[model samples]
Target: MNTVEAPIDIATEEQSIEVKTDNSAENESTNDTSNLDKTEPVPIDVPENPEKIEIARLSSIITNQTNEISDLNARLAACQQHYETLLNRQKEENSREKQSTVMRYAQAEKAKLDSDKRCEALATKNNDLLKEKDNLQVKLSEFKLMNTKLQNAYEHKLSELVALKKELEKTKEINQSIDASLKSTLNHLKGESSHLKEQRESNERLKRDLNEQHELNEQLKLQYKQLTEAARAIPTDDEQAQALDTLRNEHNALKGKLTNIQDENKLLREKLKSSDEDRLALENVIENFRQTTMREKETTKKLYDDLLAAREQDSVEISRLKQIESLSNQTLADNADLRQLLEKEHQLLELTQKLTEKNSILQSDYEQLQLLHKGTSTDFECIQKINEEQKSQIAKLENIEKSLRDQLKELDEKYQTVNKLYEQSAKQYDDSLSEIQTLKKKHQANTKDLIKQLQQLQKPKFTNNSNEHGPMLLTSPTKPIANKENSNDNSSSHGSPTGSFSSLNEITSLAVPGSDHIPRHTPAHQQQQQQQQQQQLLLDEEQEVIVNIVDIDRQKLIDKLLKQQKLLVRRNEKIEFLNDHIQLLTQDLQNKRKIIQTYAMNEDSFMYTSTESDSIKQQLANKNRNNSSSLMATLYNRATTTVNHTTNKLFEQSSPMTLETALDVMGKLQSVLEDTLLKNITLKENVDTLNKKMPIVKSASTMSESTTNEAREALDCLHELSQLLNTGLDKKTLTACVRLLEAGVHPDALAQIVQVLRSETRTTKL
Candidate 1:
């Protein structure tokens, strides 16, 4: 009954251990199931509730297996402990019995040796005694000496025995101490064995638990693999199928979005192309407009220039009319002075006639007195005839004197008229001299102003020097020679003095002779008349010379005025044309500016859209990366669990009793664990590398998108600017106006227009 009860107690203990192991394994299985729940994909074929049932069933089985394994491990540990304790006790008993038998045999052998030594000594001693008695009897006389020798030897032998006995006692005590130490050692060994048995039991429990956990993991892994395979092989449930369909639909939708994006890109490209074309057209139009504006400006300038020229011409004509009126007044005054002188000459002629009549009456009275004296005297007839002839002669002489006096008076009047004409001519010459002086002052001021302008322009001094010298060379030498020749001719004409008027004596002599031979009237009168006519002819010639000089001066003034007026007109026209052209250009510039602003706004909008698209793409990529990482983590966990399960199965398949095989398997497992750790480290390093690079990739992507947008905006702006330029060009054409001005129509205005055209052409080229 006690034996049965003991077996029952052992069984009960085992069951309790199993129960505990079952609880621990159940907890572990629950943990693994929870992890699986977190990682596992939704079952494709099974219903949601069915998956829960299957998980519960797997947990229950795992718990049962763990309990059985724990019980077996507990039993194995208890049996090994009992066997080791029995072996230790048997070894201790056998050693004690062997030690006792060896000790008894050694004692018996020592006793036997001692007995043999004593018998040998007694036999030798008996022989020696008998020999000694005989020797004593023989040598009764040396008996005392021999007795002393025997006594000394006996004493030495006794001392030797005492020492040997002490040695034996010490050896016996040492052997007893050795037996006590052996007993103590045996007790310690027994205690150690018991401790080892307890430790082995604990290790067995741990191993059993580990085995159970491994088994449970294997079952779970197998179930999961099976489920996964089934999910993959079998058709999914309606809901799962619907989810897959939705995913497919999403993929198709994404593709459609991509296609739409491509289409938008194509549209953008087309828009860009159209914008470029529009830019080109606008540029052409702008060029034309600019040209036309220039032409209109040139035409307006020409008209203005012509008007100014006409006005200047009118002004010049007015000035000429004023000069002519002044000259005519001066001539009329000179003619009046001449007419007064002629009237005085007429009065002198009448006075001379009255004087001639008185002189004739006196001559007749004298002749009559002479004739009466002649008639009374002897030769009265001859005296009377002589007195009559004397009277007749006297009368003729008075008539001649009267005629001479009249001729002299006419000559004096003619000289007076000539002198008056000369005075008038001198006054006119003085006026001309003053006018020339004024002209000279004006010319000097103009020359100085020209020189200042030339200096401002930095004109070469060589050209100015050449111009001054060229005119000097052309006029100076010839003018000096001509002046000297004229002076020489004047001196020669004066030296002759034949036509020169002498003092009043020559005048009297010439007048007296003419008066005396007056022929009493007719011949002297006719000769005086011819002289007066000659003086009048000379006066008329002088007046004609003055008229010719005045005409020449007037013509020159007219020409100069016409030229100046024309120049002023052209300059004014050019200024007006330039103003109009500038106004047109300003309008064109304003239009171009507005177009550029619109283009800039559009470019900004495009940039915003591009930025948004880039952001969306970045978000999508990040989402895809996160999903991939989660999937990899799930797969890695499943693989690790499966590997652990596989190792447990391999251990179970091997024989536990074969220590060498177990050791080999343990070494392999150690190597495999090391390899797994290395792989884990490598994977962790890879993940760290990816994590470190993520910011850089994001920054690069953002930069690329920004650059692309900036480039597109720049291109658009350039296109718009080109379009504006083309539009401006299309609005005007200036070439025809330029050509018209090129002709001599408005030369000064034309020159200005040419300059403007050149500048515009350069700008367009640029």
Candidate 2:
């Protein structure tokens, strides 16, 4: 009876445990609904003749099963705690993954921003390069125009020089003829002067002879007079008659000699008159020759002055040629610089491409990180679901077998779907990769074509330059030869014009801006020919140097461009290789992620499946024992369920409310409150300032009417004045009004002045 009572006491205790389990089951999640039906109490039968040994065996068995149940419950509790810890760890890992992903995303964004900035900078650089190219092109056009003009000017100067040379030759011929004629005239004049001197000496000798003959005639007349007187005194004798006869003969002979002498004297006087006339005519001819020579000298001097002026013009042309050479050199340097800038632009483009590729890679990495973060989050959720399932498994051990099979079917279906998705993704990835390869090949082909086109385009330019320069180079040497010939001819022809020519040369040399002048020798006339030859040689050398420098610069630029092109190609190849590498890495990362996901899913499925089998076995064993000890088994299950439910609830509620979490939340709230307080203080200060200004505003508005009216009137007048000023008033009138206003004249006075000015203007118009 006591044993039977003991069973009844056990039944009452079982009733209390069942009531507790019912309470716990009600508190548990809806997942345990199927197990709730099994918690109902089964009626117990007490035997009238109960055996002590049987009761003892039953009690002992119940005690042993209860101990096993308690142990299993403890183990389940430990597993639940471990699962909770694992969930917490998983959550922390997910949060950390989230943080890392966010950082990676931020880094990617920063890189994108940097790339954008670089692109903008490159765009600006491209614009600047374009502007420079335009400016250089304009400069080149100007240089071409200048070159054409210079060529025309040079041709004109050459024509002028030829004309001058012809004129100089004509003048030289004229001068030579004039000099010969003058020599002939001078010789004739000298012969005529000598004839005149001889004639005069003959005339003087004739005059002296006539004077002697006159004195002898006078002495004879005196002797004849004395003889006549003596004859008158002596009378007539025969001897005296003979003497008179002799005297008469002598008288007749003397008279005959005197008559001949007088005729000769008359002839001499006539000869003297003729000689005087010839002398006067010769003197007049000499004066005429002198006048002609003076005129010829003046004409020659004018011709020389013209030649010197032409030389000065030639010197100016030479200076201009120097300027052209300098400009050409500058243009060549500019072209080289432009080429370098173009190469830099190409490099910048390559850099931009590389940056774009890197940005794409970073974007991919950021996406991958995001996917990983998502995967972790999903894994965490799955783990939480698994933990919840584990708790439900503990609570509803009876239905675990059925639920496990369905869950396995679901998991299998999910795995199949995941596999299908992975396969599809792999196929897509392969297709994309193939497309990328094809695109790369096309791009490479296009780049090759473009390079060929560039080379083709450049060939024409180089060929044209070579063709043009060939003629210029050929022509250049001939220019100095021609110039030297001209100088030699000028030096040979220009004898008497040396002083004026030298002075003109000095002036021309000085007129050459920025040209270094060689100091002139004292005997410049002697050195002129040597200096001309030297100048010709210098000009030839300078031209050769210019041509060579241009050619060298062109070749250097071409070489540099080619080298830069090759470098760019190499860099492009490297970029392509790096891009391929990046693609491969990205593919590998994706594969790794897929692999990790597969591993996680497999682990979850294996864990879930393994637990399902154990739970099912346990349920089977419990079912077997239910026939013999249903009441005890029910009580044990109730007790275990209650403990598990209570523990799970406590852990689930406590997990999010740790000391650290509470502190973090409190700190956030405190910061928010502080921000709000600061905002409120700022608002209050703004309101106070507004309030303080309100009174002042009101007081000003409440000012005396007379002053306010005056102020308003002044403002109106100013506004009207502004409008009038804008209405096309003449500057003088406007300035006068401004001055009147500045001098503190009233608006009325200014207005009256303006009206008067307007009236005056109207009157003038009328």
Candidate 3:
């Protein structure tokens, strides 16, 4: 192979050098003739001067030389044509073998290249499918999480609805109880007010008359006491009689005071009992509040946990997407490496095939030369012609080498410029890549912060549960009223009137009615004066006692009313809080579901905003709370009629779709994955088929060392030849029309260019 390739290389170099020498010699002869033409122009008229005649001779010699140069140029052109004809004949003899070998090798190389490209494409497609599958899986997981979150939210809303129903029931019962209590209280107050007004008039009249009677009785008692003292000194019948009459009046006054006190005590006892019942009811209400607050706390904890889990799942899904992206990048890089390896292998195989063909050709040529060596003497002259042709071929080959070297130098300069441009592009790409990384990191950090904010938002809020049953007035006087009444009756019925009177006198004061004539100077007068002062003090004390009893009864009624009012207010506050909480939760659920739905729908939109959550809360609050209770009641009544009409519309409008919709999405994803998997399998099969059909089975390692080196050299030469031919064809393809309309035999520039292009394509394939 080396011997054959070496001779071809030497022949091409010699041919280029000979062409250059012939061209240079022709150029020198033309230049000398032109100089002669300029210095010694042919005289248009015959000149008889000796000098002119000498000039004419010189011009003739120059003309002869010019003719000679022209003849030589024509001879050179004939020789070149002859050499080309001989070469064409020789090429024709070997053209079929060389073309078949080259075509076979080129076809095999093209087949290998096409197969490798198909395999590379298939591999890229498979990688894309795998990447898509991974992306779908991540989406599937995210969708599942979204579905779960939606389900949890649905259940939570249901629970809230149930709780609200219960609360509504409780509120209704409370309202009923309050209505009943208020009605009863109103009636009682009405009766009490009317009766109290009547009692006030009677009491005022009784107090005035009783004060007059008491005063009269006191005056009489004072007189009787004096009469008794006088009677004690001297037994007077008239004084004794007067004293008994005064005692009778005093006894009557005492009876009236005792009856008034008994009535007041009875009313007080009833009020105390009512207060006790109210206190018990209020205690029960407070206990219920505590129980409800505990339930709310538990519900809040569950909601927080669900939210946390959803966030974690979202983060995991994002991480999975990142991993899929990285894996796809790796697959692309691996594909690029495979393509480079395939190209190198194709080059090695092509060079090896070329070496084998060259070695066989060289062996055949050696045998032909050996046979021709023993021919005629004329054969020696043919050998000399062949030798001259060989020298010209060597010169031509040298010129080709020189041209190739110049092309290489120009290509190197171009390559250096291209390398600089490539470096600049690489730097720009790196900067852009870094910017993308920084942006990604910033986005991640923002997402993390948003997640943290969401977590904070998810934290349970403490509902203020005020223990409002604290104002319990436990002043129920439970003394035995019946026993006291019996004892009082027995005391009034059995005890001697005067004996009781004497006993009552020690404990009470006698009031004087209209005795303003009593002197303060006399002992009796002073005694009467002191008794009147004492009686006045007793009347004031009794009046205050009567007032206190009425106040106590009214105070008990007011306390009950206040307690009921407080309970109603407290209950209203609690229900309002619950309603507000439910509304807030509903809004939050909607916002979260919207975020989840958005995240699930668009894989690229990773940045979900919690700020919108607050907006949703506000919107719902404004929407729900704008209507008062009356408006809400009206709307509720309208809902039944509108429900059927709006249900489908609302369902469609719902941003977070139902579990069924989510499930449908999952089904679609699975179907897509299955389709992708099927395509991937088909692609893999095609790649396998391509691999099976690829040629060049034995690798470079199977060839002998000498053959491998020769092949490497042949590969290098072939690569150079292809490059040279491609450049030469590109430059000279327009030099002549292959089908000339004139007499000149047109050069087959177009056909040769086509051949050169085909060979170049084959070399590139190799």
Candidate 4:
């Protein structure tokens, strides 16, 4: 009966301990549920869709926590009922075994003390759980704050988008206005062009009239010179009078021709005035078009910039969202880790239950031994020492678990920081790549536009130059046909013209009765006709020479333009190569930085090249500020200088430089640069190999630093040059100057020629 009472007491104590543990778990779950419920909601006056989703998630989390807590409470209540039942059974046993009640009571007190110690341990565990829950609550609060910030950012983005839309609408209106202006200008230009064509025809006719007047003046001068010579040989007063009559008749004919020439001159002057007015109108229209195009370009650039800014903002927001998601995931992981810890604690409770069962078995064995040999008190004290050792071991394990948990938290934080850094780096890389692609596309488009503009500009110049040659081109085919017709008519026409001249001479002779030189004067008139025919032949030859000179000049201009285009293409290629190199260098630097960061993150886990890492970091920092831009600029400068040197050298060797020769020279230079690039790449590989083979970190670091610095400087130079390239060189007048320079023209000569061309263009425009 006493033994049964002892077993009942042990069972009651075990049940009480189980109930205590369940109550502790219930308390912990309750605390977690309360913390979840107490989590602050995002402070928003007007919640959007995202806010609603977040609120729903939070509510779900609270409900889940509550349900878990309720389950724990139920478990605890069941444990409490079991403990009560066990306690009643022990009380009944105590009543039945009254003889050994005092010993059983002492054993019960010991069990109670053990149970109290375990309850204290459980309370500490519950406190740790509460602390974890508090940490979770803090994280939730931080998440909520982040959400609020994101919402604010979202609202700001929406506002910005709306503003952008308004700007777009305004731009559309402005574009419409520009289009309308363009259409009006185009119509105006069309009218001007038609008027110019009519004026051109009038000018051509006036030129013919002026040529005729000039021939008449030459003929009159020759006749006067002949008459003065003949006057010296006058034989009598009658002959002089006859000469006077003949001179008077020639003077009358000259006066009538002069009057006709003056009328033509007046018409030419009136046409000139009309043309001047038309030119001024056209200039105004051109100015208006230029202004409108400039405004359009400005608006388009503003829109592009705004779009890029918006894209960047979106990317930033996406990065932020990703960061938030990572943080939330980390929190969930931590929660999972906490759940695992709780599960382990539950497992420990089961182990403790098993140990208690074994303790009960040992106690029963000790009781049997005490009954067999009444001196087992020392053995019981030994069992107590063993139990104390187990308790110490359990305490050490708990301490180790706490240390492990702290380490896990540290590792998690480090991982999160590293992840953030990696993400930021990747984002920057992607943005850079995207920006580069866009810039390349823009460059191509701009180049195409420039080419088209150059072609358009060239067309007008060609047309203007060709206008002077138009009549020559047209007359070239008709001249032979007219000459053939003239040859066929010459027999009949010549006889008729001679007979008329003879008849006029007779009439003049009869009218001047006592003249002896009338026949001689008829022969002199014939001589004048032969001289006029000779002058006509000379004029035709002079016109041909003028046409040849014009053709030569046109050819030279075309060749120069072609050379400049080739040079521009080579320059563009060089720029593209430099850009690619910069991108590659940037990628390499990013990769190295990533590696260094990873090394730094896992410093304890692996050996790291500290010197190399430090050098790389220094290089990166320098590149970020000014070195990169300077490096790019220097590299571009070097390439351009090399091209200039090569071109000059080739220009000297080839006295008559052709387009093909210039193109070949440029290709050679490009190849040389490519070879140099390849050599540099090979050298880099060799250095890397050497570094791998031998730990010459200082040397490697020094080399890398130098290379990085140079690269940075080149980048800077390239950026500055690209800016200049974009801003400068828009004027059509500059094309000739650029072409001359590219064609290896002497600067002084080029300047003079450009000035002359510019003046000529200005005159023409006027």
- Identify the superior model by lDDT, candidate 1 or candidate 2: 2
Give the alpha carbon lDDT tens digit for every residue of 614-682 in model 3. Answer: 233333333334343322122222222222333333222333335764465345445545675699799
Model 2, position 171, has a per-residue lDDT of: 66
Error of 4 at 360 (Å): 33
- State the number of backbone clashes in model 4: 20
The CA lDDT at 744 in model 1 is 24
- Where does candidate 2 clash, by residue pair? none
lDDT of 1 by residue, 505-561 (tens): 233334433443444345445444344333333333332332223233567667766
Candidate 2 clash total? 0
Off by over 4 Å in 2: 1-206, 241-245, 286-290, 320-766
Q: What lDDT, from 0 to 1, does candidate 3 have?
A: 0.54
Score candidate 4 by TM-score against the native.
Answer: 0.25
Off-target runs (Cα >4 Å) in candidate 1 are: 1-238, 326-766
Q: Alpha carbon lDDT of residue 430, candidate 2?
A: 75
TM-score of model number 2: 0.22
lDDT per residue as tens, model 4, 1-766: 3444566666677877777787777787787767666654545664568777777877878787788779777977886677556544443343344324323433443344445555566566656656766676676677667667766866786687678678768876875786576556555545655665576577578668768866876786687677767777765477766866777686688678768767865775675567557545644654555555556567667766766765675576567557656655655665665556555554444443333333343334332322322233344446558767976997798689779977986897699669756865775687569656865675566556655654554442323332344334333433543443343244224334233333433343243332233243354443433333333333333323322222324475477568756865786697679768967996898699769857755564213434223323323433342433432122212212212233323213333335764465445445545675698899999998997867678778889999999999788656644543554343654553454344344455444334333433333454
